[model samples]
Target chain A: MDFFHVLVVLLESTIRVSVPLVFAALAGLFTERAGVFDIGLEGKMLGAAFAAGAAAAVTQSVWIGLIAAILISVALSLVHGYASITQRGNQIVSGVAINFIVAGSTVILGEAWFRQGGRTPALAEGARFQTISFPDADMIREVPLLGPIYADLLSGHFLLTYLAFAMVPISWWILYRTRFGLRLRAVGENPGAVDTAGISVIWLRYRAVICCGILCGFAGAYLSLAMTAGFVKGMTAGKGYIALAALIFAKWRPKNVMFACLLFGFLDALAIRLQGTPLPLIGQVPVQFMQALPYILTVILLAGFIGKAIPPKAGGVPYVKER
Target chain B: MSTPYAKLPGWVEYGLIPLINLAVAFLVAGLVVLLVGENPLEAAYHLINGAFGRGEYIGFTLYYATTFIFTGLAVAVAFHAGLFNIGGEGQAYVGGIGVALACLWLDQTMPWYVVFPLAILGSVFFGALWAFLPGWLQAKRGSHIVITTIMFNFIASSLMVYLLTRVLKPLGSMAPQTRTFAEGGQLPKLDWLLSIFGLDVGTAPFNISFLLALVAAFGVWALIWRTRLGYEMRTMGHSPSAARYAGIRESRITVITMMISGGLAGMMALNPIMGEQFRMQLDFVQGAGFVGIAVALMGRSHPGGIIPAAILFGVLYQGGAEIAFEMPSISRDMIVIIQGLVILFAGALENMFRPAIARAFAMRGQRAAAVVQTRGA
Candidate 1:
């Protein structure tokens, strides 16, 4: 393929791989920014993915499934919020429990309800996300040096992919510009201060967690309905954890988190491409290595770089009402 | 029923705590099964029976408990140092591989006297290696053990999967395990003891691993309670700054504790390789390291406490599998639900028990009031 074709493939694939991560990372941002450590993103995404796929298959419209998935995920996130925020339970354990709950529950429910063990019924084409066709600006292709790169790197994706990129700026603007953002950050950094200021720390955390839930919902929707158009077992496949790492690697900055997600996505894309290419000694180079590529990069990026990323001081501490 | 439980004595509270934990554990398992439309009570009944009903099943449970002791102890020691060593999974695998390698390399030429010690030591050596990196990172760079250990798990898993498929692939076969250990490398099984109990020996794979696990637990208890190093580890766990202020090298302790934890857990692999797998085979360490976290947590990270906790875990494991077949109603995932519950209740022990104890004392007052009223009537 020509350079232009390669660029286009890279562009589309990057969106396909990174959208879920971007959404998840952004979800993580809302929680972390509000001072709630959300290791439950993996569980939230898995739960949402199953719910969305099952809903889509039954409803025959991915849109309705997406909405229901968001509602369900938000509800589940509330469980985490209640346990951590109200009960003042251990956030890490609660998060771990949520993950376990979703992982085990999804498969059990799937097997019984659909009679398909660990998977949902496949979606109809109508239930699947369709690509949006944009008119080729061939004139741009004929223009100066930057034209081909632009065409190759910027066209043809599901609407959500475009929205994934859009959410970062939206998150950034909301976090830095709005009243809600200020309250959220304040609650995270100092619940006592937020409380003394007459704002309910509980409400602020709940709001942040709910926002996180919606993004995670969309991330799950993207994996099952948008990217592949089916729900396989564990299809989210630790993307939520990567998103958590991305959030940390970005050090609570939305744009940087987006960049981190894209970097991991790039390595993922690179590994997938290398699969078809011939290499010496180890023929085909076991797909397991490629499958593990993003996680390995996540590990390195997190261990190496996140050493410098500072979390909100009160991040994992549950806020309790004490006079 | 008016809060069913009221105030209680301190010892009663302590004894009833495990009961509450057991109840909660089954409830969690049952609830999960119920979600799939299975009867919770029936599922649990089968699970309970399956885990402890037979000599063979009990043997399997003991077999599991033996390894769990290692991983549990590994996690417990690290917990003492305030380290979350998720790398137990990785360390155990490497250690298992070490045993496999030693057995494979020395199987034909070496006698049992030399080969067995070398193989076990080899496992410990690799286990330490597995933990060293994360320990080093935490000590030197102040990296969170939780995150770094998680990273190592992924790396170890990837490496192991590759080894099974490529480098460690068995001869003349596509089987995912190494060739069987030589007779010299195998641990001696006490089949005669099972026959004494009127049980078929082969049914219960239980062997000498239990003794070693017991010795290790006592060793851990002594290490934690009796020694200056133990005091330092506890101090470090409670307050790293305080330990440092006391002239203790906090970083060195962190590394040493993790190394010891990982090495002991590595020793647990000897049970399966020398006793059961015979072949250093595929993915045998199924979540033992992770489950070790549950065991340690439930045991409250106490050495004596861990044995009972490990046995409880083993019973549930064996029982959960039996439930899968015998009951056919309970889903096999009952084990995870039970595990999750054990962790939950163990974590909540103080809060749960404190209230119950206070309420019990209040009940005594109510009984006295009732007697006075009856006498007046």
Candidate 2:
């Protein structure tokens, strides 16, 4: 009812919506950093969402759903890897093909399996990721601002939400601190250099895509198992693209990716909130304009209207060893 | 991977290669059909029979091909210039706005003949405008065309939703679409043309747009194979560095090529909006732009090849609809799977079979050379 509460509520929704973007953008970070352009993130996520939803519905276990999602997503990532990394093919074209494949197959398979018009059955509570409540939330409720912020805004989120946030620092540490991170970034920038230094560019890129697939699996599982009750056809919508935009907007940095996703998520929440509300002076604000803002802003950012977004130096080019 | 292989004969290079790729794609799709518990042979029979069993069915297939031709040419033109114009979908969607505006303004007073030219211009203008930013950004600002064009697609979708629901929707109508066009706005169907072959089209929306698409394909062929601009585009496509060395303006060529591609993509709306739907609707493009990529890839980015490739997709689409009716388990998405496979094999893994083909040719050539040496001895 109060201003702070309304703000907290909006922020809470923002966090919820940004979870998938966070996971997806981080997934993209690994692949792109390792010199593999993955426009198929959307397809991978959608495939995993269907897999997770179907598995969860069948087994009534969220953990099984997560595992299934991972397996399916990883399979897709391998296809992309084989095409771009192994075949020396066009990365963009391969990614596009993957996207179209998953987009259609998920629906076809879902229909054949469930007969619910390309949707998995609605999942029971046990099949979905459960929300975890902070300890002593009832006792702490009387403490006014801090209590509401901690208990209401921060606590009572799906387990994946916490994991998604935790992934930020973990990803940052892996990207900047670890040995694998160094080789990964090095491969993206100069695969030839990495090759010269006795590192297998092909193997490193494969591992990065594997990492990408694992993270995308989490993102997809979170969508069907945590955010929604079941898998719906085309449910990821353009989140994968939005995640790509967020990655570019963030300049491919892990910390910036989180902020960019949260910002986009906030905009999405605002659009939903302002759907029918008339604003002062401007009168009715079309929700479409708000919805389009992220894409439009991304285009602008891509055009270097703001700061330039430079991808990895060797990104999108398939590496070939000199014979 | 960059090493050049033996040069292939013309037939093998163009015809046999694409055919093999198509066959492989279908084989994979057939396997998927088998996985779905339907006999693959039965599905294929139904698919073929559905596509060509009746004159009306052929009309429907060609009608679908009309849209593909325009989009395919769009992609082919861009391909000739080494630019991947993924904004075709967005361009086509926005292009409908031009056609709608022209129809809404002049359909009451003008004849279809008068409005048609103006609509073409308007569609091309709007579609080119949608692609121009991405093109210009790629040219001058070092932005990736793929990413920018993709972003434009989302923007166009959102923009159309707003325009249809808020601005274009007829008063009190629940649907998000414009008012139906008047007779002056509608394209005349090729009923008489079909009757010449003693085949009745039977409710098929095949119209003048099919002819227009054919003309556009011819135009693309001439432009790509004959004209000076086409030469520049092909040169740039093959080697940008060489093009730059040869004094071709890289930025100008990129922008112009994208505009031309966008214009061609935009013209695809004429088939659906004027020939079929008779009005602008949200999502009217309906993946045609994306299909253009497959068509271009399958056709090897030649207008001559694109026509047949476009018609093949037309078969898949029309026949897939029939399969959906005949076998409820095998949905239209099966056709989409075929499409994806075609793109994967024809576009991304295009050279998957090339090495083997090249080796076969190399061995045959070596044998011929040995025979010549033996004859000389």
Model 2 agreement with the true structure over B15-95: per-residue lDDT tens digits: 888888889988988888877788999888888999898889989999999999999999999988988888899999999
Task: Please give the lDDT score at residue B191 for candidate 1.
Answer: 64
lDDT of 1 by residue, B1-377 (tens): 01234556656555667667667766766667777787877776776688767778768888888889999999999989878786788888878888888888887888766777887788889998889878887787666677677667767777887788778877677777787777767777766666688865555668776787888899999999999999999999988888989999988998899889889878888888877877777678887887887788777799777888899888877877887787543455556656656665665232455565567668888999999999999
Q: Candidate 1 on A168-239: residue-level lDDT in tens?
A: 999999999999998899888999999888889998899998998999899888888888766777788778
| Candidate 1 Cα errors over 4 Å, as ranges | A1-4, A136-153, A276-307, A320-323, B1-14, B111-113, B170-173, B193-196, B327-330, B348-377
Q: What is the TM-score of chain A in candidate 2?
A: 0.98
Relative to the real complex, the DockQ score for model 2 comes to: 0.79
lDDT by candidate, in order shown: 0.78, 0.92
Where in model 2 is the C-alpha error above 4 Å?
B1-3, B371-377
Error of 1 at B290 (Å): 1.3
Kindly report which residue pairs in candidate 1 clash with one another.
B6-B359, B6-B360, B7-B358, B7-B359, B7-B360, B7-B361, B8-B357, B8-B360, B51-B319
- Could you estimate the TM-score for every candidate? 0.89, 0.98
Question: Candidate 1 DockQ category?
Answer: acceptable
Q: Which window of 10 residues has the lowest lDDT sum in candidate 1 chain B?
A: B1-10
